[model samples]
Target chain A: MTRKIPQIICALFGMTLFLLYFSQHPTARNLNLTILNDYFQIIFAFTLLVGVVSFVKVNLKAFERGEDRSYHLVSVIGVFIMPLLAIIWGIKGDSPFMWVFENIQVPMQATVFALLAFFVASASFRGFRARSVQATILLAAALIMLLSRSTIGDMIADQIPQIADWIRNYPSMAARRAILIGIGLGSLTTSLRVMVGIERTWLGGDK
Target chain B: MDAGTVIAGILTLAILTFLYRDNPVYKLAESLLIGVSIGYFLVINWSNTIMDLMFVPLFTQGKLMLIIPLILGLLMFGRFNRKTTVLSRIPIAVLIGSGAGVAIPAMLDARTLQQMSATVTPILAPDGLPNISELVVMAGVITTLIYFYFSREHRGWWGKSATMGTYFLMIFFGTTFAYTVMSRMSTFIGRMEFLLSDFLKLTQ
Candidate 1:
């Protein structure tokens, strides 16, 4: 009963929304957009609670098991205190919550981001070895783009930017668009299947 | 130094610490990110859903019909309690139904149909150059699609065609990786700048 009911409901709702989107009526469009937006926001709210609970559960479990309990303590304390402070006192410029976020959160995200640079350098070194015609073209294109995007590119040759622009605007865009089109088709078919109740993995699993 | 500036500087330093190695500083930063993102999501939803959607329309415009969906939405919380969790199915059912009703036509109109239309373009124009770019795009699309056809063996022209398509696919992946790297490097740089300028006030 649980399985069948949700599947049917999803099929009905997906179809309605799909039709509403294509329909000419402003009222249908407005109703569909508004309701979906509402649902999205609700989902977001509940998901936040889920995240908090998950964090606490992991850290507390670690502490209980005597596994790297100190770091766990720091994480749990940080999570609870930072949000509590923000909620109670508000996140003004001088507030501790805002300070922690700007200092701690932003930097951490940036650090993860920075690791990608070294990864790229290593990958490029390995990737650009011109063992094939395709590899040679790729290496050439990357070199051109790198040079053209910088001031030194023009110092060496005036047409570097033009070449880069042509490569990006023509070949790269063409390939990307083709891939996007294929993806779009696949996504559409899946969406249709779900709407019709033929696909039901999203509501947990197929009934 | 100003408090805001100091905080920014510290964050910048913390970010830079990642380049050296994974440490307690990096972990602290990572945990905080998870915590704050979740918090931001919560606050955003509260304001957008509870205040804007449910309360405003119903109270001011007298759209009392909205109450049914509101009740259904609230019932989703029954998942927290074992005894009443089965009742959560009612709301889930409604969501599934509504979701399906919304997706089908849009998928057909926007994705499949439009994509097909885009592909049906002129391969050769009056000016003799044969629209080389369009020819390549068409060729790539055809070959790649053919490569995915699993019912038969990719032999002779089909095999050669799929092989050529794989080259294009590799190039695409490489370029994507390169761009991602650049983006990450810039992020790292931004963090470093914050630390130098804001935290230590070294550049004054």
Candidate 2:
């Protein structure tokens, strides 16, 4: 009964919401949006609980197995304690949670990004080799873009902005529009299949 | 330099040391990333979405009955236990239904009708220079659409059109790749500046 009832409710909810979204009725739209917003909030609340629980379970299992690098236990303790303190006391300006986030998360994210600078240089050097006419054109465009944005390039010549503008406005926008159109068509097709229940991947694994 | 900046500089140096070699320092930085991301997502989700949308709305309206969604949300945790994973389907179903409902009309208008109208704009506007751009766009669209048509052979004029269409497609794709590379480079440069200027305080 538990299983059957939930499935039925889900199917009905799905149909109603689907109808409401497409329906011209304002009331239906308002209700649908409100319900969605509420659901999003609840998911956010639950995800934190899930993360802590998962971390504890994993680390405990590691400890039981006597994993050699179990000093990762420090990280597990740090994770739970910091968040717990933040949640209980609330992180005001300069609070521990705020401090952890600003100092730890922001810096770490930035460092990872800094490493990507090396990747940019490497990927360009490797991939931008002009093996063909098409490759040559791409390298040219990339060179122009790189130069136009830098003070050194403008020092050499002043037409950099005008060239960059032309490339972005005409060629770039044209290409982006074409790709966007293709994406739109593909999405439409997928949505149609979903509405008809032909695309049941979203419902979970095949029966 | 301040104490905070010095500490930040050390962390930044430890991370950038990764470029020279994959050593213990890089591994430590990498491992912390996984833990920190999990923690950050959890906190940000709660603060941004839960407190603002769910809790506040429920508390203000005096609708203590809103606990139904909360329970439903909790039901998703059933997946943690193999035997009770079926219970998670309730919330998953609600999510799928809600998602499909919200996206359907918006998708139709944005993707189909608006796109078609945009493509079908008046080619030769009276005042414009015969609207060469529009003509080129229309040609590109029509021929490309033909290239994808599977029902018949593209011969003669159709063949030439499709060939021209292929060039247009290639040019479009090349532009996309270059732009993507540029955007990624900017992000990389921004991060380098954080390490060098803000964290290291080596550069102003």
Candidate 3:
């Protein structure tokens, strides 16, 4: 009964929302707006709380198992400190929370993302070898793109940028459209399957 | 220089050190990054969404209907209890159902229909001559779609078209990869500028 009820609710709500999008009635639109703007917003907010709890639980378990306990402790402390700071001092532009975020979080996040530069360079050097006809085409296209974006490319030739733009606008865009259509069709099928209760993976365990 | 700039510089270098080798310092920085991000997100959401939108409006505006979602949100935490884990599925179902419902028509309209219409442009330009680029785009779109059609055996003309499709896909992927590399390099440059120009005052 517990399992069946949620599945039914899922289908009901899914169908309602799907139908609501096409409805012209003011009441239907109002109801949809309320549910989306209010209910979904509130529910999503609590989902973050769920995320934090799950994160802390994993870290706690890791600490208990003594697997990189110090790092886990630091993670937990960092998590707790931000909220504590916000609660105590408020998160205004001049507050301690903003200061920590600007100094600690921004730099860390930017540096982490910046590390991708090294990884991409190393990975491309290994992977971008022109081993086959298709690979050669890819390598040529990539080289053109990279060159077009660089300062040296402009000095080399004006035509390089034109060719690069043509490749991006025509072939790249066409392939992107094809992929988008495929994704749209796939998602539509999956959504319908979920609405019909055929896709019960979300029910999470042996059904 | 203030304490914030100094601390930011140290953390930036700590993260950069990972490029050479994975050490405890890198691990610590990674952990702190994850921790701080979660903390930041949690506090921001609590203030912006929960307190500002939900709690404040509920009390000040006297919107009693807000309690329904509030209860549903609270019920999500019931997953922690083994006996009440089933109850958590209610909110999960609502979230997933609504998300899928909203995404379905939007994806169809924006991704499929709009993209298909875009590909339907005239092959001939206003000068009454066939535009080579438009012809190539049309051919590329058709061939790429054919490549994804896996039910039929790839032989004869079908095989040729699919082969062409693969070439287009390769170009697309390669362009994406190159663009990503460029953006990543820009980010790296930004960090270097911060360290050199802002922190050390070595370059402008």
Candidate 4:
């Protein structure tokens, strides 16, 4: 009974929202918008709490086991400190919370992403060898695109930029659209499966 | 000079130290980053979303309907308790159902129908000449779709078209990779600029 009730609730809500999209009736539209704006928004906020609990639980367990205890301690301290600062001092532009965010979080995130530059350079040098016809085409396209971004491209030939632009606008766009359509169709199928109870992985039990 | 700039410079250098090898400094910075980001998001959601939208509306405005969602939200925490784990499924189900429901029509309209319509264009230009670029786009789209059609075995013209589709796909992937590299380089440049200009005051 416990499992069945949740499955039934899922189908009801899913079908309602799906149908709501096609309905033009004022009452249905209002109900749909209300559920989305009010209910879903609140639910999603609470879901973040679940995520925080899980994160803290995992890190606490690691700390208890004395595995990387110092790092874990730093993490726990930062987590508690930021929220306390924000709540007490308010997250204004000059507040300590914003200060930590701007100085610590922003730089760390940017540096982590910056590390990808070295990794990408190394990977491309190893991977972009012209071993086959497909690889040759990829290598040529990559070289053209990279050169077109530099001042030397125009000095070599003005047509290099034009050719790069044509490749992006025509072939790359077509391939991207095809992938998008595939994803859209796949999502539609999966959503339908869930609504009809064919997909029950979300139930998360032996059943 | 300023504490914030010095702290940022130190953290950035610590993270960059990973390029040499992993060390405790990098690990500490990474952990702090994760923890602080989560806390930042949690506080933002609590104040902006929960306090403003949910709690205030329910109490101040006397909206009884919100109680239902509030109950569902609280019920989500039941996952923490073994006996009440099944109760948590109720909220999870609603979340998944509503999410999927909302995404379906929206994805269809934006990703499928709009994209398909955009692909349809005149093969001839306004000057009554053959538009080569338009023709290329049309061919690319059709061949790419054919390449992905797995129900039928590739043979004859279908095989040739699929091969052409693959060449286009390779070009697309190559362009994507090049652009990604450019973006990463720009990010690296930003950090270098911060260190040189902001931290050291070496450049104006």
Candidate 5:
């Protein structure tokens, strides 16, 4: 009954929402909105809470095992401090919470993403070999694109930008569209499988 | 610089130390970023979702129907307990099922049908010259789709078409990588600008 109950709930809600999409009735629309907007938000928030608890628990356990103790301690402190600040001061623009988010969090996050540039550039230099026809095509396209973004590209040729634009708009776009269709079909089948109780892995068991 | 800017600059420098090697300063900054981000989201979610959606409506407005979701949400904590673990699946099931249900028609409409319709363009231009761009686009679209068809063995003409599809895909990946690097470089440039002008007050 344990697994059965959840399976039943899944099928029932799945079919209901699926059917709800086909209807234009006011009642059906209202039901959809309430479930999606209000219920989903509340439930998802609790899921995030679960995530936080798990993160803290894992780090605390690691800390107990004398693994990178300072890092763990700092992390744990950071996890608690933001909420503490928010609790004391409201989450207004001028509040400490927002201040930390804007200054510390945003800059550090941006820097981390930006750090990838150097690594990717170095990786490309090492790995981007034109060993075959396909490889050559890829290398040429990337070279053209990278050059088109910089001043040297203009110095080299006037038509580099147009060539890059054409590559992006046509061949690249066609590939993207094919991928999107494949993904959409895959999603449809997977969703149907889930709705039909075939995909029960989300129940956390192979059964 | 203000206190916030100074603190931010220090943290930024701390994280940037990772390029040299992972060290104490970089580890500390990385840990703080992870923890603080989780906490920030936690607070934001609690305020925006829990308090506003559940608590306010349940208590002040007396939306008794909200009790259903509130109870379901609380049930998610049952995951920590072995015996009640199965109960946690109920809420997860609801979330997954509803998501799947919504994706069905949405994906069909937006991703599949719209893209298909967009691909069907006029073959000839107004002046009756063959539109070379459209023809190339058509060839690309067909070959790419054929490349994804794995049900049949790729022999003869199919093999050649698949090879062409592969070239287009490679071009896509190359362009994508270039654009990604460009964006990251722009962001990196912004950080350097901040470090030079805002933090150290160094004139270029």
Candidate 6:
């Protein structure tokens, strides 16, 4: 019952969802919306809760061993503090929760993201070698793109922007489309496999 | 300056310290960021998904149908106990199965069919001089697809086409990297402006 039940449920739900896409009936559409709006989200939220529980358990367990106690404490405190603030002041615009989100959360997030620029620049400097025909083509394309973004492209040639735009629209775009096609086919195959129970790995690996 | 701006500026500068090297200050900020973001998301999920969707509907409106999801969601906690670990697989299976089912048709329609349709443009434009850009894109698409085909050993004419495909792939990778760098640089520049103009008042 334990193993078979999950597979049964998976196949049933998968088939039902796939059929709903084809059915033009009103009930079909409503059922689809309900599943999307309630079922998936509720289950996902529970998964998140499970994750939070695991996080706390692991962190507290580690704290007992005196490993990175301070960092763990900060993380746990952060977990509690937001909810506590929400309960106290509510999630309103003038609330301390919003204040923390705007000032502390957002600024920190932006700074961290922005820091990637330097890292990427440093990485390209080391990796963007022109040792072969392929490497040279890649380098030239990258240089064109980067230079077009700045004044250097215009100074070197007036049509740099147009050239970059053409490359972006044609060669770059065609490759992306091919990748998408591959993903589409792959997803379809994987979905069919799961539907037919061939892909039982999700059931904790056919144990 | 407001207290918010001052506090934000300090945190931003503290994080920027990492560019110099890892330091105690950066570590503290990093820890706080990690913790706070998790807490924030937890609160959001609790409020939006649990309380509003499940609890409110089931309790206030008395929608007994919601019990199914509630039960499924509760199953996720089964993973915590070794004896009940297999039970957690129930909800996971439902989630993945339904998601994959929905994605099958969606992926075919949007990713495969639409893209293929777009690529199948007329080779000759209205000017009738054999539109160069369209031909290049068509060629690029065909060669790139050939490059990705792994079932057949690339040899003879196939090898040549696959090699040509690599050039297009390189162009794609290069532009992608360039755009990513530019986006990051834009964000960095924005942060600097915030620090100078809004917080420090160093720039007018």
Write candidate 2's Cα lDDT for A55-89 as tens digits.
86887788678873434554565566566757876
lDDT of 2 by residue, B1-204 (tens): 665566556666778788899887766665565566666666667776776666876889776756777887788788798777777777766766566655666666786567567777677779865776666666766666566555778788887766665655555655565566667667767767866788666799
Q: Please list the residue runs of candidate 3 whose C-alpha ends up more than 4 Å from where it truly belongs after superposition.
A: none
List the candidate numbers ranked by DockQ, top first: 3, 5, 6, 4, 1, 2
Show pairs that collide, candidate 2.
none
Instruction: Tell me the interface RMSD of every candidate, in Å.
Output: 3.0, 3.2, 1.0, 1.3, 1.1, 1.2
lDDT of 4 by residue, A80-198 (tens): 88889997899999999999999999999999999999999999988899998889988998889998998999999999999999889988888888888788888888988898899
CA displacement after TM-score superposition, residue B183 of candidate 3 (Å): 0.7
Model 5 error, position B140 (Å)? 1.6
Once superposed on the true structure, which residue ranges of model 1 sit more than 4 Å away at CA?
A: A91-100, A205-207, B56-62, B81-101, B124-128, B202-204
Query: Across all candidates, what is each one's fraction of true contacts kept?
Result: 0.43, 0.34, 0.79, 0.77, 0.82, 0.83
Candidate 2 at residue B183, lDDT?
Answer: 72
Candidate 1 on A8-61: residue-level lDDT in tens?
666666666766776778898787777677664554455445456777888899
Per-residue CA lDDT of model 5 for A1-207, tens digit only, reads 777888889888888888898899999999999998899889999999999998999899999999989999989999999999999997999999999999989999999999999999998887688899988888999999999989999999999999999999988888888889899999999999998999988998623
TM-score of chain B of each: 0.85, 0.80, 0.96, 0.94, 0.95, 0.95
Residue A30, model 5, lDDT: 95
Candidate 3 backbone collisions, by pair: none
Model 6 docking grade: medium
Higher-ranked by TM-score: 1 or 4: 4
Please provide, for model 5 over B10-125, each residue's C-alpha lDDT reduced to its tens digit, 9 standing for 90 to 100: 99899899999989999999999998999999999999999999999899999999998999899999988788888899999999988888889989999999998988899899
Model 6 pairs whose backbones collide: none
Give me the displacement of residue B143 in model 1, in angstroms: 2.8
**What Cα-based lDDT does every candidate model obtain?**
0.67, 0.67, 0.91, 0.90, 0.91, 0.90
In model 3, state the lDDT of residue B48.
84
- Report the lDDT tens digits of candidate 6 across residue range A1-207: 787888888899999999998989999999998997789999999998888888888878988899988878887887789889999999888999988889999999999999999999999988788888788888888889988999988999999999999999999998898889889989999999998889888888535
The C-alpha local distance difference test score for the whole of candidate 2 amounts to: 0.67
